[model samples]
Target: MGADDKTQNNAEKLGGKVQEGLGKATGNKDMEAEGQKDQSKADLKNAGENIKDAFKGK
Candidate 1:
């Protein structure tokens, strides 16, 4: 994947982790779930980018 996309995805994943940690510390189930969802979305985007790169023989 391109550098910018990769960086953005990484940042998103990191932010999600922070959110999850905060939620756990504060006993907020909704925030934790949302954080997990954000991480999943970032992961999916990375997977899609990888697939595109593979198809392009990168």
Candidate 2:
């Protein structure tokens, strides 16, 4: 993946982790779920980028 995309994904994943931790500490199930969703989205985007890069032989 490009540098910007990778950076954005990493930032999103980190943010999600923080959110998840905060939610768990505060006992907020909805916030925890949202964090999990954010992480999943970041992971999926990374995976897609990897696939594209592979196809391009990069």
Candidate 3:
């Protein structure tokens, strides 16, 4: 994946982690679920980029 894409994905994952932590600490199930969703989305995007790179023989 490109540097920018990787960085962005990492940031998203980190943000999600923070959100999840805060949600758990405050007992907010919705925020925790949202954070998990964000992390999942970032992971899916990163996986897509990896697949594209593989197809391109990078």
Q: Number of backbone collisions per candidate, in order? A: 0, 0, 0
Q: What is the lDDT of residue 22 in candidate 1?
A: 90
Indicate the residue-level lDDT of 18 in model 1. Answer: 89
Q: Candidate 3 on 1-58: residue-level lDDT in tens?
A: 3768978998999999999999999999999999999899899989988888888888
Clash pairs for candidate 1: none
Model 2 residue 9 distance off true place after TM-score fit, in angstroms: 0.7
Error of 2 at 1 (Å): 7.1
- Please give the CA lDDT of all the candidate structures: 0.88, 0.89, 0.90
Off by over 4 Å in 1: none
Q: How high is the lDDT of residue 49 in model 3?
A: 81
Candidate number with greatest lDDT: 3
lDDT of 1 at 10: 82
Q: Would you list the rank order by TM-score, best first?
A: 2, 1, 3
| Among all candidates shown, the one with the greatest TM-score | 2
Lowest-sum lDDT 10-residue window in model 1: 1-10
Sorted on lDDT, highest at the top, how do the candidates line up? 3, 2, 1
**Candidate 1's C-alpha lDDT?**
0.88
